[model samples]
Target chain A: MIAPFKTSYLQDMALTKTPLAKASYAGLLIALAAIPLVTGEFYVGELGGLFIFAIAGVGLMLLTGYTGLVSLGHAAFLGIGAYAHAIMLAQGVPFLVSLPLAGLITAAFGIAIGVPTLRMSGLYLAISTLAFGSIIGTVLQKWDKLTGGFDGFPVRPPTILGMKVQGAIGTYYTSLIVLVLVIWVALNILRAPLGRAMVAIRDSEISAQSMGINLAVTKSIAFGISAGITGLAGGLYAHYVRHLAPDSFDILLSIQLVTIVFIGGLGSMHGAIFGAVFMRLLPQAIAMVRDDLPFGLGRTPGLEPSLFGLILVLVIMFEPGGINGRWVKLKHWCKAFPLHRRAASRRQKSYAKSERLR
Target chain B: MESLVGLLQLVINGAATGCIYGLIALGFVLIYKATEMVNFAQGEIMMLGGFAAYTFVGKFGMNYWVGSGLAILATAAFGYLLDAVVLRRVIGQPQFAVVMLTLGLAFIFRAGAGIAWGYDSVAFVTPFTNSIVKFGSGVVLGADNLSIIFGTLVLCGVLYLFFSRTRLGIAMQASSQNQLAAYYMGIPVRRVFSLIWAISAGVAAVAAILLVPVQMVDVNSGIVGFKAFAAAVLGGFGSIPGALVGGVVVGVVEQLAGFYLPTGFQEVTSNIVLLAVLILRPQGLFGQVIRKRV
Candidate 1:
């Protein structure tokens, strides 16, 4: 790894100061920008969904990874954002205005739940969010007058200056633009004092408090920001899917979001994007190979969930560093290929501390 | 008088369902108190127990009582293996890892059961089935409901005696209080933790067996675990009696709400109660306040 030798503070804090890093990022974006023009409609739609999930994953990673607060109910936030955006559109609000409005509303929800639950331990926070998610889901279903209940809600594409933002290509570009904006915002936030405070609270709450950080305020803000970003994704999601069902936001979806933050890696931004890619592509992979498997495993009703479960269990147990960690190690290995030693870059010895006493 | 009988009957039935929830909560409390790890798969384990009982009694034509006893034993063994093989490795990891791990296991267990016993609801005949006990001239109660209550009481009494009187149970308690100290005191802390899991799984099996005459066992029956979780939190996470009491309270409230309120209220009663309890008194009714040590 190249050691940073910065002459100024701003240079050190810059998101990507190295020319190598800059060139690569610019290249990646250009490739993504080019995908819609060359790829088929099917790929555009699938990639669009990947971008949406990536948005939510980045949001969740901010909370669970940087803030050390795990949320099992993010699907509820996604649903609320989608429904709110759709409802506002139904009232003739412009699409551009409603998207950000939906995000703000979901952020309010995050802060509301965060204020109370953040006072407890992480375990309790997890449980409380689970309940909160289920409660919102039920409310959505039973309040048929607003959410349309079991019948589901239909979403109409937004018109931006007489140009209808519908179809696969439009949604793909919309989500990709939002994803880039989110990543940029997240990068800026991480370099600010609020991000430092969040990381401090995550590392050690007591020490963070001793250092004059308002634990509660910082935590709630982190949750609010995370939820707000997910809500933005949800607003985009409504246009992508064209229909919203209450059942779609159940525990399974919540678990899947957690899987993204977890399997992607806990503390890295690239992990979030990588995880979203993996999650969105897995079903397609399964579908492609459905008829070729030796056993009848492909035709099993619950095979997908079970496989997701197995992967989750295996990942947590064997590779807590996740896909991003592996990428880092591989790069390190390749850099020292001629004189590489496995022992030099092996997984660090983890010290597991008990959460019970502290 | 007839209306009073109806209310009493509802209470009785609610208490029975509550008793089942209590048993499940008790399992959660026992495991949590001992190992400090919450098992999200407790309901799935209970579902497995019911399927086991069905296999023995329904398929093999074994005697009902013997089949149930065997099922409990087998499930308890599975619980022991579950800890030694899978859960033990994740020790010292973050709490969220355990949560996700157990959740994954729950999904696996559900799919496993579905493959073994199809998705359809299934039940076998038990002694309590179709039996009714008359209470004076106005009230009638099903034997299955009575059996559930009776079974819970007997089980609790047995557990109380075992914990207070047995040496192994004392060792289990020692390990739970302080793992390092218990290890220094010649206790096998890991084995005690595994045994605690075994006891918890066994308790879940008993609940499943008692529930058979009242309701059929299916792949979806594991959703009851979520309700039991509410009960555990309501009673205080570490308190044994509190779990059972919290469960019964949630149960009765659910029944009352179903009878008096709109139809949709019943499905969400436990979750609502859970949220309410966490907001109002995070420590729970019988929980001891614990301060984190630096």
Candidate 2:
């Protein structure tokens, strides 16, 4: 009876309002697909760069946003995946087999770390992950034969489906396809019982345990799943960049991933995509301005990180929920129109309280 | 006989290095006690402290003692300003917010230092008497090592006295233990926090000064701060003596592991040791083990 009743027109525009909203999602997908056609090699490569980070950001959202595990060593899993892919390639394994194997290996490593560290909470867990990243990078640098040491190893592009997969377009297509598939899997996982358990733990681990969730098993599995996704991204990144170095997978990269996920708004898949694009493109956009602007200071090489830090500080201080959150407010305003002003006034107090808690 | 001598030398050197780690970890512990937050910029603060001293002595042609003292003072002031401006607003925020803020601070400080001092590593002259002392079976220790060990010991002794015997230190300790109760008791919680930042910065400067003699100074020197953080966790969070033991354990483990482990594992010895400590006994050697009521 409720499904057959007519809904108010205003309610239809909100996310998850109806099946019609999802049907319109196809339009957005089409627009993304058409981007490569109009964009040149360099620009497509740039978008591909965003996709690489988006893949990892998705998993981090699962861990930090949904699973309540703050990982500061996610780059280690990425490194593992990249190195695993490289090692497999050197052994002449096919790309199809190598990528999945890399994910599996990273998942196992994650489980190994998670099982031992399941008892830790909050800051301890974060630092442990940071340690993992540091150790992994250091080992990669020292293991000369396997990782090619400090000089790093050059990766050959994977050949697939009788086509010699190479260059910007090939890599972009591969990345896009993989990202879409991974996202579908992530959404499915999020809707499952395990996903609800992860969220329950995030909201209140004690409560989750009280309700009969096996805390240790759930935490480890979440970690393993997240690591596996991160590994997939890393494998793609190595192939696309065609180079792997210890410096490429530093603690800073892990920190960056966490920051991007935060800036996009945690626990939202759309937020992950939004965050990935913003982070990857921000520096590039700044560099573009530097090239165009007449200022001498703009030409400096190391300014990117400083600028990134400044932007991050500003975002954290002023807009904790990030761009996606802003979009949500904007959409709400557009739909509410004349009533928006009164609604926003009532929201301010509650919003401030929530922000403080976060 | 030669191997025994080698082991002795390694232990002495490790102890000296551990002293520096302990000093840095002390900075971390102090800040955590005051703010209940990790200062990721602790290492960068140490780097800036070293660079400040370097600039004063090398560029300004000042006496070493005067330059070092001035640099320490400057770093302490900087630390206070950092807390006042950035950390104050996030007082009740989640731990991740503080972590991110410190991470950002670290990048800013590191990049700013890179610009000011240039990226290349530079040599720093220690003010200590640069003499090497030889012991039995060809074992040797440097004067700089002696200074570091002595300096850290003296600092710890002074801190112990200050915390236990002085009004301000005791009040600060009370504030860290429970801010609400401390406030009710008429302790100025905010003032104690600012003082904690100042002291942590001062200690970091001392660590930086001591460390310069052992390794060449650069932007990366701040990484020693991260190692110190690991040392702090290994010893047990909020435990002063534990920080000391943890630092020494990490330093010795690193030195010995580098020597004994296959060459591939040498560079990672510090991190591996930290991960092992975290996985096994995270409460640390001197830390009071805690169990959740739930």
Q: Estimate each model's TM-score.
A: 0.97, 0.91
Instruction: Please give, as one word, the docking class of candidate 1.
Output: medium
Model 2 Cα lDDT, one tens digit per residue, A1-358: 0022347754532334467757777777788789988978898898888898999999888988788677889999999999999889878898889998999999998998887777766677777788888888887887778899888888978878668888988888888888988888887787778988999988777789899999989999999999999999999989877888878899878988988787887677878888998898888788778866564557655577777677677666666666776777777678777677644523222110121111
TM-score of chain A, every prediction, order shown: 0.95, 0.88
- Indicate the worst ten consecutive residues by lDDT in candidate 2 chain A: A349-358
lDDT of 1 at A210: 96
The DockQ values of the predictions, listed in order, are 0.68, 0.38
Quality of candidate 2's docking, in CAPRI categories? acceptable
Q: Model 1 segments beyond 4 Å from truth?
A: A1-12, A345-352, B292-294
TM-score of the second chain for every model: 0.98, 0.94
lDDT tens digits, residues B187-272, model 2? 98887898889889988998888877777779878888778877898888778888888888888887888788777565676678
Q: Considering only the true interface residues, what is the Cα RMSD of candidate 1 after superposition?
A: 1.6
* Candidate 1, B204-280: lDDT as tens digits: 99999999999999998988998898899999999999988998888888898899999888989998998889889
